[model samples]
Target: MKQYCQSILIFFLGLNLAFAQNKTENVFIITTDGFRWQEMFGGVDTTILKDDKFVRNRDRIKNAFVGKTAEESRKKLMPFMWDTVAKEGQLYGNRWAGNKVNVMNPYWFSYPGYNEILSGYADDSINSNDKMYNKNITVLEFLNKQPKLKGKVAAYSTWDVFPYIINDKRSGIPVNSGKDLVQGNLTEKEQMLNEILKNYPSLASDRHDFITYYLAKEYIQKNKPKVFFLSFDETDEFAHEAKYDEYLFAANTADKFIGDLWSYCQSTTEYKGKTTFLILTDHGRGDKIKSQWTSHGQKVSDCYQIWMAAIGPDTPALGEVKTEGQLFQNQIAKTAAKLLGYEFDNGKPVGREINSVKN
Candidate 1:
């Protein structure tokens, strides 16, 4: 009888241990600034490809992204996203298919869009992408304050304005932004990366996306933050410059970076089987026609339409969601919190948690 009781206790203890392991969920929120849903889902618009004003080297652009069909083209552009994430996770905001994901902010600009994404609401006052500090608390701030997550939340962004947008001073979260030297002890590779950052030419407004990606990846490998935000901005910059070829290249490269990050997470014990990745854009740019593809703001129609993709243990492998429904960008904050087994309440009226991503 004593041996039987001992066996039952051991079984219950195993169950408890499993539960604790499950609770240690890691969340990665990544964004590509102003990346339109058009190229994301449909791939390089043929109209833009033929337009001499946008395409200086037509053959080069076509060979890189253009295929027989939209599906084939997009797959070529984002092989990891289309081949792996699409099969293992869910993707929303295919407007042609009736699924729509939009930003709540009417401004449809970078600062406002990112604010709504992180704070779960639209603030009309944050219309400009200036260096002004954000007043509202972000989901990152909320998570950093949590007992288990304190000092374990980090943000790395390519845009220089992120330090202001995230209000790093107020949140007390570590934010590494444009041209900033990496601090603290570093590995040999990290040291080399730091030297490159110092010598690399300034091609974009902020830092190059590749630099931002590598910095974030190195930090994650070393610190293993509970929650991390990696934001890339070259897509938006290239679009604004009307450099279609560079824009597509940046988008394709971002896909590869995300794929590499996902693979790394799966290979590590701390992140394997417990990490969730939420990939999205800050806002969408203009349509292919109407000569507005380079701009995004309140005046740009359809600029609010964005795309979001998720992959994790909690999310169902529904692939591309074609169901008739509308999703708002504000839900991202609550969704991130939910995936980590917590509720994000900013004490203000905000978006609800995304039910589809929860277990």
Candidate 2:
């Protein structure tokens, strides 16, 4: 009788552990390439768009500026962002703070900027005005190795070089982006779209990570991946063109996409009340407005200033606290790992686990 009682107790304990493990929430990371802190928060009081360059899209710039400080403008331009996350969790201009080095310094162009953020260490040995080719271990690689996280991590980018940024082949995680093409079973719509891509071969579809967005949303709803990394490359492309109106449109579109993702997460029981979102830029641009059209390769360039915002259930609800906590782009790897209860081994691992959702 004593042996039978002990066996029953052990069985119940095992079931309890499994239940706890299966009740995991998710973390979503989104990046807007070459996003600028100045444009995001610089008051309309001094906005160039408020003056000579003002157009239909730039008009939104003026409306975006409500109060005196950068924080105020940010709140105005992104009401949902401010009310939902920044006000309660953490939001700041990484550039105004002393995070210049890790904030895509050298103002070096996109590939290097992305590599540093992903690899978590700046490499002086590399400096090419070309796309990256070598595969480097990323935060995704580390997170995917955690117990039960395998086949649960995925990445989507708009750039052609994303295959190299993550080296998805080695990681075995599904990566979709420009020209990479989505593989596996497809819906009827997808099958039609694939046929279209082959026939026209010239028509521009929403080839950006918008497809990645759909895939991520579908996977979360179906398979429920624990970690999701999404990179929107359209804004960066428009920025390079120096078409202010186009750039603004791209930013606004990306904002809407983010809003949609948040809404979707809130509707799901597994992640509705538990998920956290981290939004950031890959690097800054130039100082002069003209040069800003196509720049970001100088260390002292004013454009190197970047911005970051986080929202979710675990972050403190302080509306817009002016705390001076330092945050580096490299810290993202550590912070994400901490939030998901995993260990990250990045070169700069001093990232604090900022509250994502209120505990």
Candidate 3:
């Protein structure tokens, strides 16, 4: 343990000394809860669409998203990801193409996956989905501690547990999640939103992803935060409910949300060419058996596999990378921090920065 700590300290020292600062002064992280790499790369599953157990409106989804080739179909399914990011950014973890990204944690679930993504450490103790305050210091918290970035980091999620997952109380980063309303002076839009959300429909424990997106967008517009995070849950919620059509729609809608947010960032002065968008899934779903597509955990096969996409002034335009290599979820925290020229170190050994993303 002593040697390990020494190694980590030295690693970050060298990392900081050799760091190449990029143009990204800010970063926006967006995630689709439990979204799969398969659908992300191959488009909607036609076989599953035909099953009564899966889709609600087969013909409608077909007409809207399906196409003859994977390239064509994926373009229809998530137009912004295909048309824009594909041309201007990098997409990782298309397993069929040999590039892969996997969860470093043992448990293939939300909290553990997110912990790895945010903390850059996969604690085996974080094995549950309960509303427990995280002990680890996330990159957000690390940035929040910075003199220049204090009070400029914020996160929002559809899941009520986010306040606990992020440990907002301890980190001092505001996490507006679930049924929580905008505090302090509320905009007229915030007032209206709060009223509707008080009676808003939800799937089990999660509020609507669209609501979460808009709420976060309002905050982003209001504050122009240096580090902003949003996690949408409908894709995972619909999959858990066995509503395949809703899941696909959620994925497609998430694409539109990304496009909208990026468009806004480009139009705004604070974000324009100075911001980077980092996108990924909290976890991955099953794949070996068709019926297991809705399930994830330690028991689920291929649930460790995940995907990520990036767009920014510094990232090279390498869409859907076909190179044969592997990356882990733990690398993302440093990747996000490094985009803005920070070495994310919380005293634990983090996965090294993804060098490819720096260019």
Best by TM-score: 3
- Model 3 lDDT, full chain set: 0.89
lDDT of 2 by residue, 193-244 (tens): 5565445442222365455466556656666777888888766666565555
What ranking emerges by TM-score with the best candidate at the front? 3, 1, 2
Badly placed stretches (over 4 Å) of model 1 are 1-24, 288-290
Clash count for each candidate, listed in order shown: 0, 14, 0
The Cα local distance difference test for each model comes to 0.88, 0.63, 0.89
| Candidate 3 minimal-lDDT segment of 10 residues | 14-23
- Candidate order by lDDT, decreasing, is 3, 1, 2
Name the TM-score of candidate 3: 0.94
Give the per-residue Cα lDDT of candidate 2 at 290: 47
lDDT of 1 at 212: 92
**Clashing pairs for predicted structure model 1, backbone only:** none
Better of 1 and 2 by lDDT: 1
